[model samples]
Target: MEPWPFDTITPEEIDALTDEEKQGLDAAVAAYIGECLRRRGVDPAPPTSTPA
Candidate 1:
């Protein structure tokens, strides 16, 4: 969690994003979290089991 932490963002907030913005946000957040987890020697969380 750097620029935008998960606890600070909500599903409703993401739903407010346009499709293109949403995709970019998703990538940025995923990468940020992945780095954080790696630094902690932990695995990143798996993706959603089903599409929203």
Candidate 2:
């Protein structure tokens, strides 16, 4: 799956996502980046984010 460009995202686009949709999107993004790092033999700590 192709990742969406961060710069292309807007608040309206994010607001349109349902809570479930948001969670799924977040998980997919994490998986994609994690796999990329794994393929390169790099293991990093999981991410931490503050609540908005």
TM per candidate: 0.59, 0.70
Q: How close is candidate 1 to the true structure, as a TM-score?
A: 0.59
Off by over 4 Å in 2: 1-5, 49-52
Estimate, for each residue in 1-52, the C-alpha lDDT of model 2 and write its tens digit.
7766688887689889998898888888889999999999999677787334
Model 2, position 21: C-alpha lDDT score: 90
Q: Identify the runs in model 1 with alpha carbons over 4 angstroms from their true place.
A: 1-13, 49-52
What is every candidate's alpha-carbon RMSD to the true fold?
5.8, 5.7
> Tens digits of per-residue lDDT for model 1 on 1-52?
4555468778789889898897787788788989999999998779876234
